[model samples]
Target: MVGNMSKKFNSFKEFYPYYLSEHQNLNCRRLHFAGSCLVITLIFVAILKSSYMLLWLLPVIGYGFAWVGHFFFEKNRPATFTYPLYSLIGDWVMFKDIIQGKLDI
Candidate 1:
């Protein structure tokens, strides 16, 4: 694991580049995008159906897909283990970037 050697970024602006580097693999990015889309749809379903239980699946669905991509496609440990908050933020940012054609899908 590269955990101990990881540099502490003072801001998300600095962290984002590193995050992007971790997710450079095309399949990994696609999985993340798919997971994020599922998360959004699930959130709306939970709200519309008033089924709070469905909300619980958010992390499972999101992380499951992402972890698979990291393990199989990226072949690297997920940054989420070391930087949960920043990683979550990166996921959304990357999702938007993909949508805006800034990042390849």
Candidate 2:
């Protein structure tokens, strides 16, 4: 598993390849896509209604689906634990890539 490599990346450019590698599973990617979509929707709803509670639920909605994908489908540890900021960026980049047909869902 890539997680076992224990490599440290100097930049997001370097980390993204490893991030993509860890999420090779189709179902895992799909779950991430769904979660990201929900996150965007929830954020919009929170803004529209001025709901701080819904804003707070963002991470839960995002990570819950992502963790399920990683654990059940990908069968690998999520990069989030070790690389929180990068992992969050990776998730959205991946979501865009999938939507734009750069990555398969």
Candidate 3:
């Protein structure tokens, strides 16, 4: 687990560029984006449906796609281990970037 201090983003200004770098490969970013989307949607669904049981699978969904990207395309370990919450935040931000067409990859 990431300590709160360790996960503290000194600045999104710094973090975003690093996020972009880590997601350099188009496929990696796409996969990560998909994972983030699935996780978020499932979370909301779990909340709305009052079904907490599936919540346990959220991490698997999130990590599964992103890990595939990291291992297969990026060839790097995910920063999630070092910065779990921040990485989660970064995931959403990157997802937004993808949806907005701000990120080509």
What C-alpha lDDT does candidate 3 achieve relative to the native structure? 0.81
Question: Candidate 2: where are CA atoms >4 Å away?
Answer: none
Predicted candidate 2 versus true structure: per-residue lDDT over 5-104, tens digit per residue: 4788899999999999999999999999999999999989988998868888888989999999999999999999999899999999999899899999
Model 3 residue 89 lDDT score: 81
- In model 2, the worst 10-residue window by lDDT is 1-10
User: How many Å off is the CA of 75 in candidate 2?
Assistant: 0.3
Which stretches of model 1 miss by more than 4 angstroms?
A: 1-5
Best candidate, lDDT-wise?
1
- Please report the candidate that would top TM-score against the real structure: 1
Q: What's the TM-score of each model vs. the native?
A: 0.95, 0.94, 0.80
Per-model tally of clashing residue pairs: 0, 0, 0
Of the two candidates 1 and 3, the one with more favorable lDDT, higher being better, is 1
Q: After superposition, how far is residue 77 of candidate 3 from its true place, in Å?
A: 1.3
Model 3 clashing-pair count: 0
Model 1 lDDT tens row, 1-105? 233327898899989999998988899999999999999999999999999899989999999999999999988899998889999999999999999999997
For candidate 3, lDDT tens digit of each residue in 1-105?
112233456876767676677778899988998888898899999999999998999989999999899889888778787777767788888888888988886
